[model samples]
Target: MPRGRGNRRQQDPIGGREQLPQWVRKEAQQPQRVVRNLRRRPPADADEEAPLEKRRRVDERQLVAMHPDVDFQKLLGGCDRLYKSKDLREPITIDILIRLNAALRHVCSSRYETIMFQTALNLAFAAFLRVSEFALSSNVIHEHVLHRRDVYIDHVKNQLFVTIKFSKTDQKGRSTTLVVDKNESNEICPLHSLKAFLQIRPGNDGPVLNKGL
Candidate 1:
């Protein structure tokens, strides 16, 4: 019995239990820390998007004014040639052209004539010169304006010819040569000449050339 009691006392264990108290005491003694982080603001570019986007959109007048290369005076000058001699000399200026354009706009039947004036100022003078070949159409006087190439073409060929496209017929995918030559060499008819001249005229108030004008 004494030996049994002595063995029981020796086998008793409290080492593992002692660790729990140490762990609890360490946890209670530790201080809690509060951490703070600074967040960066969003990029400054995001705030500027509205005004930047607004500036990208332009109105009609703004767009027109933006085209610095277009000459309104020269265009008016070309169109001025379509009128009678006395009227044609009225100075091929933008002011006169705008007035004439405005006046022509009122006449429904005169739509194409207004277009012719616009074309003179907007298109190359060589193009407007083609109108003279057609008798039915008003004569585009040489003094007001003349396209360089068209005049060159006339000088080179010694015949009147105008630049025009002919996709409807055999000249199929390419620009068809219209003969304005009085010599009747492969040139286009009077109607075609008129059509070609009118087709290339400028629709807006723009500059072209003063050539003879």
Candidate 2:
């Protein structure tokens, strides 16, 4: 004979209570015990100074003790002078850039190479670009390196938009577009030089500056 649904025994709501020891079960049946609140230990004394502050105080005392007659401001100024750079790098001027362009024209073996070098120099000077921004460190092309596709020419606006995908300042790969306007001089005009270079540049995708092979 099959058992009916109503004939089955009902389970205890607290099923695991039977498995517990009698003492534990008895304790559980009683009201919950009062629990004392726990608290973190009090912070260090408010009057106590930080390690750096203490060190600074100690340093000041030593300085005063050793050099009682020396002026504190003058001593600090003298210390600062010790770390200052002595080498002064001369800034690049327009005359230097023009001379460089002229030198490249004579030095480059082919017109293609000359245009490429000239355009790069002009673009870098006008945009204030770092060498790593546009040029590849190795022979292999990186995603961050400027590509031919990254350059856009606006004939109507007479401006060229160059996208810098990565730079020292922009480590997060947040790209920035630099707008270079047409220069008055044909020799140093980035837009004019870029246009001439693009005309001869290969249609294949790669770094903007490449061997015209």
Candidate 3:
């Protein structure tokens, strides 16, 4: 085991989702008819409730929720361009990832955030995971949230399997699995990075990517 003092990674771990309510379901679904009705009515200038961009994001979220496989993420990029509006996010171009890896090498912290997040970034890219798919949802329990038990790495086969307990796309809680296999590209190879991350054994229980010591 890697030698380090006790760290209070996440002072608490939720035991189950029954303890929490999924606000997204109620917030995101609006009977399509309601969506259409809302579109027909122009907002009053004095109402000033939510910004147009906020509405745009909700619309985009609906699109992604409905057609999870159509590369709506890319389509949303076009929306930003045509609307002459910009999303704060940018695509992970080759140059940016390279620069990110270089920077990760120099991050100094008590919780091993540098190594932890760097490995996670590599894994997320290889696994094509949405952050929400693995990250903790407020008030969610460990059974529904990710734990160290969820990751399985086959060093001999150079593969990894991550059990995704829940996803917006997988509403049935069927525990969708994500695979990360060795790729020809060494610079961005997730398998190798994950191997390195495992060597540290972040802990057997706790959020895989912890925020602090």
Report the number of the highest-TM-score candidate.
Answer: 2
TM of each candidate vs. truth: 0.20, 0.58, 0.52
Task: Give the per-residue lDDT of model 3 (tens digit) for 4-112.
Answer: 3332233225653332223544656655432336555445453465476456667766877887888976786888888885568877866777788778767755336
For each candidate in the order shown, give its overall lDDT on alpha carbons.
0.41, 0.83, 0.68
List ranges where model 1 is wrong by over 4 Å. 1-88, 110-117, 120-213
For candidate 3, give the lDDT: 0.68
* lDDT of candidate model 2 versus the reference: 0.83
Which lDDT tens digits does candidate 1 get at residues 110-184? 555545444343232323333333212234433222332433234454554544432224234354444443323
TM-score of model 3 relative to the true fold? 0.52
* Window of ten residues with lowest summed lDDT in model 2: 40-49
Tens-digit lDDT string for candidate 2 (1-213) = 464433445445677333544455588999863435446322335325555455676777798888899889888899889888787877678999999999996899999999999999999999998889888778524888889989999999999999998888998888999999999998999999999998899875988987775
The collision pairs in model 3 are: 16-141
Instruction: Provide the lDDT at 154 for model 2.
Output: 98
The best candidate by lDDT is 2
The number of clashing residue pairs in model 1 is 16
